[model samples]
Target: MSSVDIPRTYGALLIGALFASILSGAVAVQSLIYQKMYPRDPRSIKLLVFLIWSLDTFHTGLIWGSLWKHFITDYGFSAEIDHIPWTLALSIVFTAVLTFSVHCFFANRIYMLSKRSWILTIPIVLLAVLRLISAAGTTVEMMILQSFSNFRHEVRWLFTLGLALSSGVDILITVSLFYLLQSSRTEGGRFNGVIDSLILYTFETGSITSAATVVSMICWIVAPTNLIFMGLHFVISKLYANSLLVTLNTRKNLRNRNRSVSGSGSPNNNQALILEARRAQGQNSATDSAFHVKSTEV
Candidate 1:
């Protein structure tokens, strides 16, 4: 380790640890609020919420455990981070699972919104699956190699590839979702408000997740020996979960917007959004005998 880089490395890891804890707390609180808001959600949606919160909380603990084991238990071992701690390796698995869970959820939404277009969603799903597998592979390699330098020297390509694919999946999901919503927008109708709000919300979430992935990869590639990249990566899955939950949790807001759109006689847009609004809320009150075709035709 270069003497000149000691402070930089320490600063990165310390800041990353701090940020991860804060974001984890934020997501934990958000998850609780989501639970309160959507007490009637379907089993599948509830299970997803459980999984996201479980993994986020566990990984946050893993970060602190690794830090304590390294900085306190094994202090003076090295001036710079070259070795990968076992807890950190474990956290990688959680990160991959958390990230893939979020990806699959969005892909499912994309699949539905794209009117069940297999072509549109299958590639995105495949990329997401590949990323998870690659991320798991990275964890295994880190465990076996046990040294950050060795991991980077031998399998950095895998690390970089996983990050790239993660970003790709996020971007694809965002664009597909926005495109579907945009296609549903009528040029002169008040319904545009709902669609526009959804668009902006989707844009904000997608951009944040994708940008975090890119910055993490850039830092790792630029300074593989430094912990700066880990700081960005640590909080990334929380961001994904938060964005998804926030969108889900705000279905009431979407409903309120849709109700106003309905007064304008935009039958098509109102119908489509109502169906979506109901689905988001996990409400199936439309019944098994309704003649209205499910509005996923968007």
Candidate 2:
């Protein structure tokens, strides 16, 4: 990479890291709020928030790792680190973490909606095994970095497989949530609307992020530009931000609904009683004020 390419590369990575960090912070705040307000199992919501934070953390780590590999390595203009391994180790770990995180998130969603404990556990175990296999087979001290061509091809294939599985699980969860919301409407349509909207936003963001990853893989295999990889990071950040927003909004709407329901009695009786009480109070106050004023004048 030339001097010009260097600035562009670092700049893009920095922007992506910042975006993902902001999103992670938002998810953290929303998670805390949800834990306090919602009566649902706190563990599930906490796990979801943690997974999201992990995704963003891994993403930012990847960007920094790439910067170190490219700029600090001997081939680059700076060349500060002549022989750092730039271990595929961190990359491998990042992929594994992200893969497991996705699996956990989907499993939690499935468990939440269907209450099927066994449904998600098996696949999660399988995914964990796959990730471990993908990470193993390296020597303790230093592993030789493959040629860019080979590395790109291998990473693309592995990412595609992992992404496909994650997206498939997400789609299943999305469909389940849709049906769950449809079947479980509450009075006033308030809770149901919030649930449906949250689900819809999650589905849309997840689908688009997965699609972008597919496109990025294609671009990697065909053209092999750093820009496409950077774009993938940005898209992932956007997905994280949108998912955090949805979760926050869902919690807010649920809290508001609960407050409204708790404050109001049965609709008809509450309204009639409120009206009659107001009318009687108004008449008595007027009569007293007039009597007092006349007595003072006399």
Candidate 3:
């Protein structure tokens, strides 16, 4: 490796390591908070959030480990020492699996949010199948190491297809989410706020993942630079952290709203009810003085 490449490689590796730590920590913290706040739905779509973060944690760790062995260890980048075939195979398989899980998670969220499964489910399933086929092809080529160069060519094609399909899925999900949010506003329901929050969280997470995948694809096209992978890793790590924070805030807000709604039914029920009704009416009035004050604060 060139002198420039050495620092770049290690720097990328360190970033991936940091990302791994952050993702892992966020998963732990979020899991505990969700468990405490919503024990009944522990196995709900939120669990998939933890699953995705866990996959990212492992993925980043694997990238970091490979970089460490290549840059820090005395072992040269021989195929055997690098475990090139095994690494390639594992990367393809695990990445496909992760993508499938993500699609499923999104589909589940859409279903829970809108009670509309068929809309998202069909496309997600199709894309997941494509990803699995691409993964299998790449893994097969890696297992037969004698055709490594040919395998790289095949893998490149698979990566390109995977990228396109994944991007399409993300775009569709984003549009669907926005549509759901718009519909929710006029069609008020019990879980409207929760649904909106989930949709926003899922859309943002998908955007981050798609962006990382784009960077990874570029690295594949140009050169196998650790910097690209590291950048993607860090992006995902930050995405997970931000997602957890958003979820926590949403949960807190929901709790506060519920409390506000419930607290008005106490011994001072008559006065509290009247006050709340006034507040509600004022909330809907364009000329309400409090509305202006709250809007200014916002």
Candidate 4:
């Protein structure tokens, strides 16, 4: 019999598992900070925040269980896990769900910031739903097939389509959000600085997810039998969860910094101060009208 070399990939999987654990812990801490700081956020926004964290916890638990069963519990012949294990499979579904959740959150942000233009929001909303469907299809395909060779022969296209859709959605959201912010910037460059930070932050998060998905697709196409893609796949969802949480938690610091800059007599300080005051009030402020709109409109 030809050697499958499946055992060789467990080391990579272990590394992935550990990396995911680290990211998950970071996400949890960020979620706590978000709750404490943004308690007055609209109920819809609060629910989204809580839901993302809860899903991240669940995904991490599934990853741990899968790794333990394959690597620690069933050492010998555990290499078969390279094909596809139930937990790993479920992790894929959880990732789809997690990715969809974040994508929807950003999509709604776009709707709000773009002033509720259906033309702008519809594409992302459709793509996100399609992504979830394709991802679910991929998961079901894996479950039914149960072997990498069979997966490769039968439903590899579904897997590729799902990842492609996911990458496309992230790219769209990132580009559109940056464009909207840049276009919405007023004179005096006060908000310009904030926009700059937002553009950078958006790029980092968007590119990471898009790159990981693209890389995974390439690896799957190039070497379907190897676990090379597993390295990226495991932590991909964590990146999504962390991206949103990080954005949410930074509001406090962003507000404080704006206040400090205002006190220093910046020309646009007046406008910044108004926005800062609104955010500080945390009540029914227009701060939510733009990207901060509390509704789940998308």
Which candidate number maximizes TM-score? 1
The reply for model 3, stretches above 4 Å from the true place, is 1-10, 42-61, 72-88, 146-151, 187-203, 224-227, 230-249, 258-298
The TM-score of predicted model 4 comes to 0.87
Candidate 2: worst-modelled 10 consecutive residues by lDDT: 289-298
Local accuracy of candidate 3 as per-residue lDDT tens digits, 1-298 = 2322655555665675576567657666765665565444434345565666666566656655655555556346433232343543455566666666656555554554455558666776687678667766666666775233444554657656766676666666667666655554423333345445545765776677677767766765676533444345344434534444344335555545544644543453222211111121223532111101000110
Which runs in model 1 stand beyond 4 Å of their true positions?
2-4, 264-275, 279-298
lDDT of 4 by residue, 1-298 (tens): 1334565567767888889999999988988887788767767767887888888899888888878877777777644665577777888889999999999888877887777878878999899999999989888888888877788888888888989999999999999988877775566744557567767888998999899899988987886677767767888999999988887777776667656654665453434412232343345554421343121111
lDDT of each: 0.78, 0.46, 0.52, 0.77
Query: Candidate 2, residues 1-298: lDDT per residue as tens digits?
Result: 2222445445654665566557656655665665565434334444655566666566556655665575555444442322223443344345445545554554555454444556544565565556445444221122454443334434546544544554454455556555544555444532344455555765776566557556655654554534445435444543534454354335444445444643554534322111000111333431100000010110
For model 2, which pairs clash?
Answer: none
TM-score of each: 0.90, 0.59, 0.65, 0.87
Q: If ranked by TM-score, best first, what sequence of candidates would result?
A: 1, 4, 3, 2
Clash pairs of candidate 4? none
Error of 3 at 103 (Å): 1.9
TM-score: the better of candidates 1 and 3: 1
lDDT of model 3, residue 292 = 10
- After TM-score superposition, what is the CA distance of residue 120 in candidate 3 from its true location, in Å? 3.4
All candidates: CA RMSD in angstroms? 3.8, 14.6, 9.9, 4.4
Clashing residue pair totals per candidate (backbone < 3 A): 0, 0, 0, 0
Alpha-carbon runs more than 4 Å astray in model 2: 1-18, 21-62, 72-89, 117-144, 153-156, 186-191, 225-227, 230-252, 258-298
